[model samples]
Target: MEEKKIVSIEDRIPKLKEARKKKANRRLLFYLSIFFLLIAAIIYLQSPLSNIKHIEVTGNKIISDEEIIQLSGLSPETNIWVINHKQLKQSIEKNPLIKEIKVKRKLPQSVQIQISEHKIVGYVKSELEYHPVLESGMIINKHNISNKGDGPLLINFDDEEYLKRMAKELGEIPDHIFNLISEISWEPTEKNKYKVVLYMNDGFIVHATLRNFASKMKTYPSIIAQLDEGEKGIVHMGVGTYFEKLEK
Candidate 1:
């Protein structure tokens, strides 16, 4: 009886080893299958089949879609997953007029871009040309940047830098005050102060300087509230706030 039991134990041990080997082989095959599938997925995503097929651009009034595409160097042939977003932003920033921009990939082959442009509050004339002045008081590049409206034209000897500075502050100023401003001027004189010679559309001149523009201008809404229809003249904000006009 003991001999028979030993023979049976030997046979059972061999069967167990065979089962363990079979299980190990099955696990190895499963892992390898998953690995190959992952590689195939990666290749598909990187190929043209998953490349950028369309492009959408918005919030671009100053820049056109074609221009954005050209500036970003993005096209239908570009791969969405492989494209570098930082490179695209740097390319668009090349345009000095662009204040801010955004770029992104929209799955399965699409790219989108959004942009905001610099605001033009006023303009300055040079010899025979003009440059648009930004709200920040900086001049934007324009060969013949001219305004065609019923407002005061700035006649400044040193308008180049002022125009650039003015351009930078356009969006920061209140819209009503901006529209009320008819003209701005700068002189290359002893006090090269950025003086704002505002001419109201309603026949009044605003004596404002760019130094404390935001804080000083904040008092304007209240001042205009106290004015009468017949009241018209210069509102001096440079020093102590006051309003005056030439003897009629």
Candidate 2:
């Protein structure tokens, strides 16, 4: 039988101490590495490396990209970490045309601004120029004499309340019928203060009131379709639905 060899406690002490020393060194090294990595990350975030290098603005029609960016109050020098997205959105929404705005950050150094603007419903004639009226009841003065699309040309609409009401009514109108309206005039009557005359692109004149304009105007296509194709006339829907052919 082979004799069993047992290591004495005194002999094993040096090896045990060496193992403990290695373990302690590994722990210290791991902590030091973690501390250095944290410091590096902090420095990187504060440095120009984290600055906004690119800015993109989209979904704007009336407001220019430059103007939207200016309104956002963000610049190339802005730090991504310190940017307040809520404040940015509020600042950009200050423009009445902007219905909603979104701000987002991309890794490295890029920012994006997405905007939703009120739809342009019509244009109010101001002297020789025409100002755009938005669905939100805001009139943009920047564009003059430049027609964006075929929308109703508002005439003699001086009352702000009436204009806003008209805008609200116009917004609810379907695109197919809304596009047919060529012009609108605020022709009020004692019976109905909200009465207005609409000149349609199809050569039919519409007499409607802003109070029930949207609901009444929705029936315009069907009413016009029933009329004689060659007969040019005035369709009355303000009080009731009827049509009268123009005298030849």
Candidate 3:
């Protein structure tokens, strides 16, 4: 500056007051905003908007959605924020069919539950009604004749111990090979109590034992591949793998 200009107190006072006024207004607006936000949050939490309005269940086949939801202990009135996901999952898993469950909360008031059921590897006929045999070697009660499952049918399997063993063995078989099996009949003798006869979908009869059945049957596809097309025979899979053609 070329010269020092003395500012009057009155002139500087208005500018200082204007700055303080602006700062105070900003602080007031901030406090008001915070207060309104708190009020809105409280209102939202108290309103039904915070309640679970929608519940979706998926990945359930044998267990019905209604049954799954009922097992979850969740309803429209249940609050999404207060859900105990672990407890709900444990509750649904009490059913033997239910292997696993996942519970998740979707924002704004919805919940999703996913269920995984045990796989049915085969079916055992009991009194003309076939019951599903799970991969876990457990058999469930029969529902209806029409509901007889898609897997291979087990016949003449009266002993629970052997049936469990058979179910476990069947579980290890690959789906492609398992599909080829139409029926398995238990024909135990004094010499070999684990004897089983399998009727294949390709018109081949298989004579196998429960011992090492899964390991031996894994080669069934390859065995059938080497045979002539539309060939019907008895496949001996015990000590040695061979074929005996039927007299057509």
Candidate 4:
């Protein structure tokens, strides 16, 4: 019985050694895998592959891509993982022309910037330059007047308050009616301080008050259609709608 017990003990010892050897091999493999993964991560982070390779700008018309990129403070040197999205968005939106902006990261290589710009309603003349006026009643003081095609011109508007209100009113008008107006001149009287004179593209003058100008101008197309062919006159739209024939 003693001899049999000794042989049984001997058999268990070899089995335990095999189990310990297998466990050690697994642990070594796990450590080696982690080390290799760390090395690969470090290599990728230091390489240009982790840098921003493409910067795409969309939904920009008046503000060019170069302008937007310059404002964002983003470049090919910017790392993909370290992008400050909020700072970038706030920077781009500082321009009066930009209403809102969205910044997005396309992992590994690219970033995209999308922007919504304020609608440019008209141009306000300042000295020899024509500055763009936005729908939000803000005027951009850019000097390059030839960058955009001509639209309605705001003339003789000295009061900033009235000018802002007029810009908002013009923006609210439908495009068809807005396009017909060639110029808007502020001509206030003692009784009506908000009076404005609009020169139409169709060779007619419009007398209107800024109070309900957009609502009243909706009927302009129909009124002009009722006039005689080649007729020239001043259309009164403030108190009531009527056409006064111009003296030949």
User: TM-score of each candidate?
Assistant: 0.76, 0.84, 0.80, 0.81
Give the worst 10-residue stretch by lDDT in candidate 3: 141-150
Best candidate, TM-score:
2
Off by over 4 Å in 3: 1-28, 142-148, 159-161, 188-193
**For candidate 3, what is the lDDT?**
0.86
Taking the tens digit of each residue's C-alpha lDDT, what string does model 4 give over 118-216? Answer: 878888887798888888778788523324844699888888899889988987899899889999999999999999999999899999999988999
Please list the Cα RMSD from the true structure of every candidate, rounded to 1 decimal place: 4.6, 3.3, 3.4, 4.5
Clashing residue pairs found in predicted model 3: none
Give the per-residue lDDT digits (tens) of candidate 2, residues 88-176.
98888877778988888887899989898788889988779877898877888864222265578888788989999999999999998
Clash count list over all predictions: 23, 0, 0, 0
Compared with the true structure, the alpha-carbon lDDT of candidate 4 equals: 0.88
Worst 10 residues of 4 by lDDT: 142-151
Write model 3 residue lDDT over 185-206, tens digit each, in one string.
9999999999999998888899
Question: Residue 89 error for model 2, in Å?
Answer: 2.5
Report residue 119 deviation for candidate 3 (angstroms). 0.5
Give the per-residue lDDT digits (tens) of candidate 1, residues 1-248: 45553457777898999999999999999999999999999989767888788999887665667777788998878777778888888998777656788887788677889888666666666677656655555555642222242223566626456555554444566777767666666543467467766666767777777676767777787887788778777789886898785567
List residue ranges in candidate 2 displaced over 4 A.
1-19, 142-150
